[model samples]
Target: MHLNYAHATRFNPPCPPSQYAGIGLGPRMKSAERFAGHRQDLARKVHEAGIKNPQVLQAIATVPRHSFVDAGLHARAYEDSALPIGHQQTISKPSVVARMIELLHKNKQPLGKVLEIGTGCGYQAAVLSLLAQEVYSIERVRALHDLARTKLRPFRIANLRLIYGDGIRGLPQAAPFDGIILAAAGLGVPDPLLDQLAIGGRLIAPVSKSETEQQLLLIERVSSHRYQRTALDEVFFVPLQS
Candidate 1:
């Protein structure tokens, strides 16, 4: 049950497990050694990689990484590499996921609501589910949604609304998020994301290109239709799929 809701919402409450147990993660299965090992690895890697947010670290640790991927790849579950989660999408590397979360909350304020632009593999969405008060996640692929919804069955996250659409457009009706995170890279920063960020809120993503890898950009919504952009670091990711 604890592992089951890792993808649904970011709520810190405990939830019951779903009986389906797709990919062998259910009541009948126990991956204690694997889970514990991944927990320790995440602790070391996240800290080594400079993830300063304790809450984010705990959320990453608590959410079972293995359950979101192909069960056959269980052995590589904790590796600091991205694995395919179908629809040609891969879960962002654990470090990348944690870093983005840390970047989103760098200003040290309470986030009222969050908009997650890409829900690939649902790993990033799961992490956001635990940290933000509310999450509006958009997934370009449909099959991923079905998988994520089922995996999130056991979590107490009630504030997340998953939508299947273009990651570039974002969720308009639920705009004005306190924080925004884009999981896929795209050429230039998407205007819709900036438009949706609430004042004093931050948006993090890679300002993308075709030939060059994108740089991690942190934009703060200073006023309506205005933002302050700061370059965080260089990052590589799948191009944002519309």
Candidate 2:
């Protein structure tokens, strides 16, 4: 049986506050207010860590990251550190996420359409939704894909689409993305991803340098067949899988 696993799940915009009357907005408001401060602090920390892009900081401050992690880990959600999200995968730290997104925005123009190679707990995708006109995220692990959908459903991010499939293969149907980002590290940028990038588009990912060392890599498609690669900061991430 040939099954198409690359189905996309689109989220709708958040419902109006009036719709929460039955649930009582008091608790919800209180929780949001509490997290608002933590988000601001986290953004400040990211700024101190050298993330200068104001829009990137704003996106970090706006997204409710706690919703993407387990309830028990909510206290550490705003910390500048990664947290395990099951299946041996972890969400990227707030600073790292900000840094990568800032790189994508290096051109200082509104992003048209972006592609995320790994959805993880859907944290980065949620943040990208705020910055990009459209975002398509793919996850290879069935459990993580479903988990990302569950975690992201409440926020109702209309611009974000979650797809269950192999991240390594890239989403050919949605190719020619304005920007592409990979959350996991591979030996080098996959050829398909490079081919999927629109001319002048940028792709950022962690590339393994050795068995124990990895570095952030930036690849820009300068023309139809020309690309520029630059090795960046040392980092670590789960190996990109098929």
Best by TM-score: 2
For residues 24-46, write the lDDT of model 2, one tens digit per residue.
Answer: 12233456677888889999999
> Model 1: clashing residue pairs?
9-129, 10-129, 10-130
What candidate 1 gets wrong by more than 4 Å, as runs, is 1-34, 107-110
Worst lDDT 10-window in candidate 1:
14-23
lDDT of each: 0.71, 0.81
User: How many residue pairs clash in all the candidates, one count each?
Assistant: 3, 0
**Residues 150-235 of candidate 1: C-alpha lDDT, one tens digit per residue:** 65554434555677677687666667788988888877777777777889988998877456768898998888767898888888
Candidate 1 whole-model C-alpha lDDT, 0 to 1: 0.71
